[model samples]
Target: MDRLKYLLSPIKIRNMELANRVVMPPMGTGLGNDDATVSEALLAYIRRQAKSGAGLVVSEITAVHPSGSVSPTHLGAYDDRFIPGLRKYAGAVHEAGGKAAMQLHHGGRESFFLLMQGEAIGPSAIPSVVYRQPPREMTLKEIHEIIDSFGRAARRAREAGFDAVEVHGAHGYLLTQFLSALSNQRQDEYGGSFDNRARFVIEVLEAVRKSVGNDFPISLRLSAEECIKGGYTVEDIQTILPRLVNAGADIIHASLGTHGTPAGITSAPAEYEPGFNVWRAKKIKEVISVPVITVGRFTDPALADEVIARGEADMVAFGRQQLADPDYLIKAKEGRTNDIRICIACNQGCIERLMLEPGSSVRCAINPETGQELIYPRTLASTRRKVWVIGGGPAGLTAAYEAARIGHTVSLFEKEEKAGGQIFYASKAPYKEVYDAWIQWLIFQVQAIGVEVKTHTLVTETMLDEEQPEAVILATGAEKIIPPIPGIDLPLVCDAFQILGDEVKPLRNVVIIGGGMIGMETADFLIDKGCAVTVVELLPRSPVKKFASHGYMLHKRLRDGGGRLLLGTEVVAIREDSVVVVSEERGEEVLPAEQVVIAVGTRPRNELKEALSERNIRHFVVGDASGPRRIIEATEEGARAAWDI
Candidate 1:
């Protein structure tokens, strides 16, 4: 607690005094009503976040106009009619004992929904690198109208009882498009020079200040640097930071990257080091008198404290960390650091779900109650039951822990000598040590809550009948699918599971069948081990291409490391020193391989399901026992099944 003095200290920004330096930065949740009004679900989520003890909870991005909307459910502050709901939003945070701020944003060319409707607008007629849709350049008259819209929105925020307002000028939005030379090519007043590029946001800040009054605090969120070639750097933007601050910005929320920036830098996968952008914030703070808020891959409070103690920034924003554990700051304040459920930055449930799945709200892969504040179980069970959870994978561990948490007598059994099931092997892959920490956390939770765990013990029907457990949760996990190829039984052949589990050491040359996530990951793992690898997939394209951020990163790394990915190809047979493959372009080919690894996929391993059903046992099947899926599904199913029990 003493070491976290800087992080736990109080700070004052304008008239609002924050209890601590922690800030829950704005994170978009597609939980608003279709008409762009606040919903009960969104309110519940915000209330829960506020209860986390953050000094300030910046609400999700709210559009200033319809043309700036990213989705039909994007929260709006364009009209006065939204004030009542916005007031409720502020009340939710205030009542929970936290300050509230509304993030005002315009998506510009990044507004996919607006582009689909042919109504996208930006400072210049430039297409966003991610969206690839050219936006209609705003006329001088239209620019003033949007600036006025921002002012009106700020006034509405103040009227709605918000402590402050944040002008979102980063991440390749309308303001960023104007500021960046890569996006803005206009020859008019809003372009051609640094002052011209900075004109729109500064004028908007002035408008917002005039609307909100002199005493109100306004935070300007900016990408410390564009983080891409041909884009503005922090040094180039330092000259404008002071000018914007002079225009009425009270605080600078310094972040990194734009829409086209790699995930390794922006949203940062597990491979990225924590506090990667603190230097950028330090740079911004050097030229500005206002306090700076740095945000980027900050999960550990100790790291945040170090950043503040070093004066890199006055505050730190833990975005995804708040989603994973709403009580993050509270737990840290209590010195229960190990008890905190740290975010692994996998981007599965939050970013991927938000972008790839329409109508889905923000969620955490590790925490099932993230967006389910209104529905997820909280109270203890009315009648404590004797629950037996089979298997020791993520699903079983979570089920055991959650059941114990809900005041049930839970016993978990694992057939293997050690627990962690698939996650045990997954952690062995390159750049996935985070999974190891996750499994350890799950196991620690189960053990800490007094859940009885028995390893090297496979639950049988006879044992269940003898014990007479009231309920059973079968999370037996899955088994790797072995294709019935001609020479699959050769001595040089094995499944990816064996390789990942360290049961098999492949030779210098290796061939992997499948081009899915696991297959690509295995190739990457082998490539790291100095193995010449080739991946073959029967599908026309990689499944990972659907969300190419992490996939492309993996693909690029694999190709750069000399790994071959053969799409639309099938494996025919395995030979002593070679494997036969067939593709559309090439009828048949033989590839030399010292070893062959199968990574097609997995199937549910529910052998006990029929046996338990025959005995009329009250049981629920969860996780891979139902179907092979991602860790998100497994943890969610586990928690839900435990609640049901």
Candidate 2:
């Protein structure tokens, strides 16, 4: 009678009873204190997700050893001193009517040498791709000490009120380093052959089980495929799965691909489908009786339910989805799926921030309240008023919807027929249609809140003067900045907007003037279109250097697709069949191309500033119109502006 209600069904793992099959997988948010013990921030974040009505919430990686800590803010369970804070975390989850688990972690060779305060140690000497450390081989004594640490961590987890304890065996952590043949090159019992390679994990599991006893539930996270050359695959997991289960693992939480492997930094990249790793979980499910928790971009509740309905996975772990919308399960159970914010898998805020930025706290691009759980909107304004939001981009849409939700009569005006001004073209890249989903949600929320959206209507100062709104939010966004080089206006030359929109059809050989995110994304699109794309930039390094993860993956894809990049080059002029450029390395040069695309950057379109000033209207500005920035800042400012009005 109901469509896909199985996602709200109950489940059990050993001694722990979950309210539903929905599990919030462990995703580090840098919420803990400097000592890596639980802080109020971590408690608040866990409480928010637990309040979402998930069946289970697995707190982010809890370091079992000092060297295992990823950052100063990573959660810790290595000693009894950390038990009190962790107890509070588990208690809050219990108060929210959800089961909680603690994932014991040890980075092994993947450890940050600088943060570890010593040389990283693994099963064998291997170079760390993430921390750039030359790790030494671990001795038998060190191996036993780490095993004892995991055992102690599990004991602490049980004492701290956790319903279950999960071993962070995946993600190229200590256990994985010993499991993967590429990383494990030791001659000891902890390395070499398949059985030997798995010995370390088995020992840790045995120690943990010996400490927690048979009554406590135990889970192990495993990577079904390493996605790296000469690395393990699903067959490896098929064999490794039984070893873990036999070693007292009551549940198998199957995650996909290892970090620092060829798969890149994110477990769920933007290119992956909603249940990309469900097939892997299914493979494990076929061989083992233990419940398998499948995790990989399972954002859509319908898709999540299908995984269980078809018997693909026993549980669905929503990591980024829960971060984007803490009320995801609650909304779905209430038959209000439309109210749930889609994750969209834009790594800009979550994983990208975690991997690239040092000491960065995890935040959501769509949901600004992710890490700020303690500071919530108290109440919507009781006094209603007229509100005008200019431009229907993310900022304007957010302001309009938020204002209306605050009991304001709001109107949003867009010059284009559709909303998502810049995002419209930005989403044209491969597998980027997810942005459209976010835009759709924004449109739905604004319409549901009764915000009058006047699209294809350009509002001027005269219109604002006549309406005389109590508040005006200017989100006009920005415009592409065309360099003042000679022949810049040539028909053969166009900006990334035109190229992405297919307005200016790219020629066989194309040379772009910029190497920023917009430029690189456009270049990637052109390279896929069988065009020879060459990006020439004025900077010596990547212009989008701040976007470490995005820049790394994007540039790699472009280069792999036969794209050429010329950094430290300045465009002098755009000719009929070639573009003249100058670089420090190569003083003067002619880059022959049929099309010269300009993607240097954008300049703020604040023309409405003087217009509103003349009208003498009460106004505020946000988003690109204020200054070109990311979606998070724009949306946050929009919501803040609405509350201020």
Candidate 3:
């Protein structure tokens, strides 16, 4: 507990005294009201983060103006009418024994909902990579008004009882659009040179300082490096850090990348290492007198503490990690780091959910109670029941853990030698070692709660009848959906499970029959094994588009590695040494391949449910047993089913 000396040490950002160096940076959850008010859901979410014992909990993207809104559910501080809601938001954090900071944001061209509703405004008429709608150039008057908007928003945040306010000048938003040459092509004072591009940002900071007075802390969060070609690098941003400080910025939240980058360094996936952007923060810290907060996958307190101890940055921000486990900092402080449920940076539950399904609140794949703190039960049930759970995948393990935690005697059965199930095989793929960490943590949690785990033991109807449990949770998971292909029975053909589970060695020349995430990942795995891979899909485009950023990276990696993709192509027949395919563009073609791998998808493995029903037994089916979906659904169903008992 005493080891995180500098990390657990108290620090002051101007007049704001932080209890520790651990910060919970702002991450948007679409839980706010449609009319831009802070909903009770938002309050509950923040209260949980505040109670996590973080030194500073910054509010997620509060719009400085309605035109800057990214989504209808985004938090707003554009007008005095929103002050009351903002007051409760600040109060929730304050009452939870934490310092609260509001992040003032203007999305500009990156504002999706605003663009959908009306014209998106920016310094120039450039569009962001993610949001391709070209924004209208802001006139001088409009620019001045937006600068005043930032000041007013900061004032409103201070009035609402927030300890500090952070200016969101990063992530290819309005301010970053003006700051970077990639987006800014203006001929006026707010463009052209570095100083000109920085004028708007400095003025906003000065306005905020004038509005909030000298003592109130004002943090400037900017991407130290844009993480793309033709974008401003850390050296360029370093030149202006002193000017920003002179303009009354109390702290520098040194982050990386913009929304324009396809490989969003902003919220990295499992591919990136922890503290990957600390060097950028260290660079910014070298030039600035103010405290610097480095953020980028700082999942572990040991890593965060090391960053601070090495003087890389003044503080470390545990962004998604705190979402995964609200008690992340508390446990780290108490020397119970192993108890913390680390965020694996899957991007499936939090960022990907927000991007794919608009208006959805933040969620975590492993921890189901992230944005559902208000609805999820925290107290344990009084009644105890003997519960039996079948399977040992994410759902089964989670069900067993939750049931055991809720004062239930739980026993889990798995046919496999290990407990991870599908995820165990999944971890064998390259850049997927994080899933192993997740599995280990999960198994530790289950065993720690006194759940009796029986691995390498398959449960049958006879076994269930002999046990005679009060309730049974079936998390038997899913199996791959192998399509009816003529040559699927060939010795050279195999399913993704076979390759991933090490049942079969990687092939030399491979043809993948699907282009979904799993297929692309399989190709990636085989490519790593020095295989020449070709993906054949009946769809016109890659189905992995559901996961945009990750898909983009995977597709790019596939192409870079000389992998071939034939879309809108149907496999007519499979031959001994080739696959015959027909496409509209290319009438017919014979692609040579040594092996065929099927990664079509999966189907529920819930045959036990029907048997249980026939036996007149009370039971619940969860995870892949209910439906083949992502880990989020699996965790939710498993935990909910356990709670139902």
Model 1 TM-score (2 dp): 0.97
For residues 1-645, write the lDDT of model 2, one tens digit per residue.
Answer: 465577788887778888888888988887789988888887887877788888888888999987676677888888899999999999988999999999999988776733356667788787656666667788899999999999999999999999999998888888889998888988878788877898989999999999999988889988777777788988877876677888989989988666666435345667777887788899999889988899988887888898899999888999889988988877876778988898977776788777777688888888767887776555778778888999998889988987888688999999998988888887888877888878888888898889999999898877877778877999999899988999897878888999998787878999988998789889988988889999998889887653354466678888888998899988888898899999999999998888988898998887888888777777888988899987877887887788788
Superposed model 1: Cα runs more than 4 Å off = 546-548
In angstroms, how far off is 527's CA in candidate 3? 1.1
Worst 10 residues of 2 by lDDT: 260-269
Error of 2 at 72 (Å): 1.7
| After superposition, candidate 3 runs with Cα above 4 Å error | none
Residue pairs in clash, model 3: none
Q: Model 1: per-residue lDDT, tens digit, 127-205?
A: 8877888999999998999999999999999999999999999988999999999888889999999889999999999
Ten-residue segment with the worst summed lDDT in candidate 3?
544-553
Q: Which one wins by lDDT: 1 or 3? A: 1
Best by TM-score: 1
Whole-model lDDT per candidate: 0.89, 0.84, 0.88
lDDT of 3 by residue, 1-645 (tens): 378898889998788999998888989999999999999888888888889888898999999998898898988999999999999988988887789999999988987876776678988887777767888999999999999999999999999999999999998888898899999999998999988999999999999999999989999999888888999999999899899999989999988888867666689877789999998998997887789999998888999889999999998998889889998877877889889898888877898889778768898989988888787777777788989999899999999998988789999999989898789767776788888899899999999899999999988888867878888999999989988878778888888988988899877999999887678889888988889999999999878773366677778878988999899998877878888899999999999989998898889998888778877777999998888877878888999899899
Query: Candidate 2's C-alpha lDDT?
Result: 0.84
- For model 2 the TM-score comes to 0.93
Cα-based TM-score, every candidate? 0.97, 0.93, 0.97
